[model samples]
Every structure is written in structure tokens, then in C-alpha cells.
Target: MAKKKKTPNDKNVMAQNKKARHDYAILDTYEAGMVLTGTEIKSIRARRITLQDGFAQIRNGEAWLMNVHIDEYAEGNRFNHDPLRNRKLLLHKKEIKKLQDAVSDKGITLIPLRIYLKNGVAKVLIGVAKGKHEYDKRETLKRRDQQRQIDRVMKRY
Candidate 1:
């Protein structure tokens, strides 16, 4: 029997915040659903979302995603969604409470790692992260360089 091949729609990643990993020490991760407008959904499906400056906050018992830029759909007219609007994240009450408590601590924050479509629905991967210090950043870079060198040597064999 042959294994089934995965299709693009299987795990369509829309946008990722590459800088998040370099700047923060991720402690825990959670998957949350997003509340998006029609045009926003279209733009996301078209791969026009940017998670570079995105972050999440728990306010009034609700989780809100901020600074994520989902470009307006090109074909959308007056009803086009705002590119930088704050979107609500759908997380369970228990999860939200835990995130809120964690975020209340000093130097800890909630960052969006990536957004992807699962079973035709959009989901955001969020991380409970603590900011990295200068020396930590340098150490990470050094380790990454060493890993690259090891990979190159292995490939040559």
C-alpha cells in the first residue's frame, strides 16, 4: 500500500513571525481560532497576512490579537477589512485565564508564532514567551551557526 501525499490545503500556513523565536524564550504554546471578516478571510487565503508585529492580549476576559496586518482583498471595495484591525481570538475560558495570569508576570508576553488554515478554518499558534537578554541572543546565534556547520559537514559525506 502507498502512503497518501499531503496537499497544500492540508496545512496552509498563512504568515509567521520569524523574529519571535530569536527574541523570546517560548515557554508554552496554544492554538486559538480567529474571528475574521469576509474580506480578511479572503486576504488571508490569498497569503496577504503579516504576523511580524503581532501580539495577543487578554482584556476584559477576552483575548485580542493586535498588530497583525491582513491586507485588504484586492477585489474588495467599500466593505474591505482594515489591514491593522484588532481581531478577537477564540480560546476557552480556562485557557484565557491561564494566559492572562502568565502575561501578568514581569517580562512575559503573548506572541503569535504563526497562522494557518486547518480543515478550511483559520487558526493562530500563540506562544507564552519571555524576552531574551542580549547575551542570550548572542548565544542563540552562536548555536545556530554551529548547527549549520555540522549540517554542511554531514551533507558532504
Candidate 2:
């Protein structure tokens, strides 16, 4: 009997910021738990979340996630949470301090990269990113195109 090949488990990604890599240079990443309402979680599980314009802010020694859109649940009626309310990010004191220091520097900001479920719990992947110049963005695009060409050539073999 032939053994079956093992496949990696599928990650339940709720939302992603597709433009993050194009707009900034990611320096460091951190995973954080989100404080969500019952309806908010259901909406997220249904993939009704958007992270394109989401960002993290460290204020008063705590971290908060802003601009992440979690659409109101269809059946929630009056119980649905606000779609644009700021959500608190659960992180340790040490991590919060690190984020605060990084964010205090010019051009350095905390951006939400993606949101996914881990062990049935919702988590946000946040990144410390530096804003890229126009030339840097062009260079990144050029490099990506060159890599794509190389991949195509290798696949032809």
C-alpha cells in the first residue's frame, strides 16, 4: 500500500491587508489577541472583515487596533456591534512598550498585516513597518517581476 502525502493544515484567515507589503517595509511582526463582541466574532468567522486600512496604536501604555472593519452580522439585528469601533489588542506589557517605542520613531508605524483564527481564537498579525519612498516601491516591484520571470523559466523545465 502506498502512503498518502501529508498536507499542511489550512489557516482560517479572516482578512488581509494586500497593500501592506507594497506600501511599507515590514521590520517586525507580532501576534495579538482581539477583544471582540459575540456578534463581531460571528461576523469575522463569516469573513466579513477588512484590514486594508487597519493600524495599531499604543496609547496610555496599552495597544489598540483602529480602522479594522467588521461588518454587522446579518441576523444580529440590534445586537450587532459597531462596524468601525476601535478594538483593544491584547498584548503583554513588554510587547506594548516595544510597540510604543517603535511607533514613537518617525516613519515607523504599526500596521495590521492579517487576521486569522488560531485554535478557534481570533488573532491579529501586526507588523512594525517603515514607510517606503517612491523609489523603494519601484525597486520592490522590479525585483518581484524579475523573480516571476525566473520562476516561469524554471517551470518550463
Candidate 3:
């Protein structure tokens, strides 16, 4: 028998860490599968997740996601998973080594950028990032405002 595919909601994004972009300059990104509990997946499907403070780390030849908040399922009773527990990220050995090497540099870190469901499986997009300086943020904001102004003027035509 052939396996069925569940791809209707392809790239269904559940949560995004908007602050991560403002706080860090992303250098590279990798999509990683997550090891989630039953209730945790339920909560995620309901869009009750917050990725604001989440980050990924490579340890013991594995990738781990930390500080992500997935709300507990209301009907989960005693089986509900912890909202802020560290979750294991499924990544290839080579990817884990690459991430480990990337973070070994000064000021470079691994951060979670977004959580999305791809083919019914929960995945996290991790970014290899460097902390942005205060002035870099201001520059980004300035450029954004200028783009908005330009677009506004063009929209008048």
C-alpha cells in the first residue's frame, strides 16, 4: 500500500518570534523537527504557542530547543506537557556539528525564528544569529520607514 500524504496546510505557520529579527542579525537558518508531547501538539495546532524567548543549542551531539512556550491543552487533564520545557530538536549530525561550530564564534548564537506545521509535523526554523548593536536596529528602522514612505508615494499613482 502506498502511504498517504497530508499536505493541504502546507507551510501552515503557527507562531513567529518577531522580536528575534529585531534583536539578532540572522546569518543562517535551518528547519528542524521537534519532539513534542501529545498535548503539546494539540496546543500548537490550536495556535497557542509563543516563540518569543526560544533558542536552540547544540549539545551532546544533539540540537535542543529551549524557553519556548506552548500553552497546555485544556482537555489534556494529567497528560498535559509543561508549557516551558526544553524540547529536543531533530537535526542531522552534520547540521548539529555545523551549528555547534557556528556558535563557537564570539557573539554568535542559535535562536528559534518560527514554528510551523509542514505535512502535519511540527517544525522549528532555527537561525544562526549574532546580536545586533543598538545602532544597527536604528538603521533597520530608518530604512524601513524610508521604504514605507517610498511605497506610499508610489501607491498614489
Worst 10 residues of 3 by lDDT: 5-14
Best by TM-score: 2
Give the number of colliding residue pairs in candidate 3.
0
lDDT of 1 by residue, 51-124 (tens): 99889999999999999999989999998988999999999999999999999999999999988998889999
Worst 10 residues of 2 by lDDT: 5-14
Per-model TM-score on C-alpha atoms: 0.89, 0.91, 0.90
lDDT of 2 by residue, 14-74 (tens): 8888899999999999999999999999999999999988899998888999999999999
Evaluated at residue 86, the lDDT of candidate 3 is 91
**Residue 120, model 3, lDDT:** 85
Off by over 4 Å in 3: 1-11
The true-versus-predicted C-alpha distance at residue 123 of model 1, in Å, is: 0.5
Q: What is the lDDT of candidate 2?
A: 0.91
State the lDDT of candidate 3 residue by residue for 1-157, as single tens digits. Answer: 9999433244498988899999999999998899999999999999999988788888788899999999999988987799999999999888999999999999999998888888789988899999999999999999999999999999999
Candidate 1 wrong stretches, greater than 4 Å = 1-11, 154-157
TM-score of 2: 0.91
Question: What residue runs in model 2 are displaced by over 4 Å at the alpha carbon?
Answer: 1-11
Q: What CA root-mean-square deviation does each model show from the true structure? A: 4.0, 5.0, 4.8
Best-to-worst TM-score order: 2, 3, 1
